[model samples]
Target: MLKKIDRAAAFIQKESELFRCPMCHQQLTAKEKSLVCSNGHRFDLSKKGTPYFLKHQVQTDYNQAMFQHRRKLIMNGMYQPLIDVLTPYCEGERILDVGCGEGSFLSQLATSAQLKPSVGFDISKEGIYLASDYGENLFWCVADLTNLPFQMGSFTRVLNIFSPSNYQEFKRVLVPGGKVIKVVPGSEYLKELRQAFYPEDETKQHYSNEAVIDKFQETFTKITRKTLKYTFDIPENCRLSLLEMSPLEWGVSPENKAQVQKNPLKQITIDLEILIGEFL
Candidate 1:
């Protein structure tokens, strides 16, 4: 496992050379295998061989072990269909993945397409590290979504998966001809999971298509949307991890968890809507 990790680290080190400080918007200088900035900010390359440059850390109840388990499930192609919808817009350009958790989707995007300079940023250190393991060619950073470090108009395409959307800063970094591809949960996304957490199924009220459309109308000229769905059987071992990676973890009480553990599956649903819009 250590040797495999070493190769992964080596690959990430090579990829790190392609990025600068996204926040400071400054050039990064390589110093003894670490990346540094002119303003005295320093980011060290990990022994595992990935660059670690998250300037601010926010504490969350999210345990690392849970996301590690999620990495396993995601690696198994459970999310491949989402990527198939994403790759068409990313070909032959620099792509930035905002909230790129564990790098699953973006790493797949980097390897599967002719896209150049695939970069991913997340506030979670663990997520960025796991992403490093998947592909060396990806530029992974730990940065706040609300205050992205990259220069204005730097990316041709941006990917926001199940992660929350920050449209204001998203539009700022995208070039004039750039596009932002956003994925949000559909009403029935993980109905089985919701059944385990909420009694009335009323929490579905939070997903707003109007909100998505309004955000797009403010920034993009041509907006297109599509919904994609698929099903897969999840193994019991992964059930706990799946639980932890979701907002349902916080929403579900102890008794609710016990109910979910009683029977964790029928078919896992990957229902989502992809909104693709071009910057005006």
Candidate 2:
């Protein structure tokens, strides 16, 4: 009763072209209250408020805690500037978000613009599952990027922010005239944390430079580059979640954690370099 209606609503909301099957990369047609593919594959939308794009199984390295912190930080506007730089490329057409953790950026893009349709894919099931609350217009999938489960030339714009990029797969799925927006850390990203954790006065801690990104740009047109930086005060309540979301998780010693807990950071730097390129 209620389950059927929820599925129906989800199906109708995903009426756009983003709900293609992850395995077959076929546009799904909602038939008899279930989503079906041309080759006879089918997946029923879950009443738990998520669309089951993968029927079988997919493994992921992410856990609920990682996304939980990321969600809060993003929603708090930690990465707003990066999203602003990438939004212009959308222009009301198809867009694909690779490794879209918790779908915060995608959700903001959908609400802020008159977007045509957008789909978000991640290797993390928990990430996608948590993303369902954003909107029905946004299609969420749990899948891998090394071998993207999408058809060729499916998207007009692709966005990869602070995530692993599969260049070959990204170029394959994007339309010939499409563009890609990638965000990486600037030379000063998280300098404060690194200083506190490592205390290595000899080693210069910094971010990726143009030379480091040269291999990435060989296949695309280098459009523009911009650096963004801001200071954020870490509240005592959310400090633990913030620590878990960082690479410092492994590098931090038990003693270091104790230090952080005792003298929690008042402010930290969020520095990033945004690169916008056109597919060649």
Candidate 3:
């Protein structure tokens, strides 16, 4: 495991010149088991083969159980259509996934795009640990999105899939002419689940992408939007996994959850808008 981590570290050090200290913004030098900056900010590689890049600890509701179910769903081809839409933009040699949960999407994208030196990071330590354990030939790290520990213009492609956007940070890390592929949920995405949880709430039945789309356009010069809408049949046994993977059920009552579990939808809709953009 240590040897594999060393290889991942070496790959990061060699492929991009953008890795920098989160604190001092100095260039990071990779050692056998850690990365160090000129000002002496050091981040150690964990036993799971992921690096620690966050300055402080973060608490998140995205726990291991959620990620595990998410991985299972993803592996079962739940997001293959989205992956097909995302593969083209991942043309460059280096790719970075911001807010990558468990690294499943990034790993699949890397394989589909035939990319090298793909890296992903999240604020959740458990997610990163799982990512490192399950993903192959990818660099995983626990890092903050706003304070990314990479040098300016270091990546050729940046992926933001169902994750929050930090436009300034994204633009800073992407090379000139590089692309950002962002996926945002559209109306009807998981509508069945939403409806199941909040049957009487009219607002819960619909979703809007106006604000997020407008913001993406405001940030990027050239933008293209593609909406992939489809319905997927949910396997009987995987229904619980599907329910557990979503944040929508986080605050629902146990009775409501049980209600959905007992009468699971046979098919669910996947409505997602993929935005491809380049810096102005």
Return the clash pairs for model 3, or none: 18-151, 19-151
Highest-scoring model, TM-score: 3
The CA lDDT at 197 in model 1 is: 70
Highest lDDT scorer: 3
Q: Write down the TM-score for model 1.
A: 0.83
Clashing pairs in 1: 22-149, 22-150, 23-149
For each candidate, the alpha-carbon lDDT, in order, equals 0.71, 0.71, 0.83
Per-residue C-alpha lDDT of model 3 across residues 67-141, encoded as one tens digit per residue: 999998888888999888877777546888888898888888778888877789999998888888644557888
User: By TM-score, highest first, what's the ranking?
Assistant: 3, 1, 2
lDDT per residue for candidate 1 within 1-280, as digits (tens), equals: 4443455344445554444675576866666656667887776666544555555557655456767767778777667888777777777778888888787778777777777767787787777777766654566667778777666776888888777778788887888878888888776777777766776657542345567657766767788888898886776667766666676767677887887777676467777888888867
Greater-lDDT candidate between 1 and 2: 1
Answer with 2 or 3, whichever has the higher TM-score.
3
Worst lDDT 10-window in candidate 3: 9-18
Q: Is candidate 1 or candidate 3 better by TM-score?
A: 3
User: Please, what are the lDDT tens digits per residue for candidate 2 over residues 43-146?
Assistant: 65555444555545776557778888878877877677766766676668677889888889888888666676677878777888787766645666666777
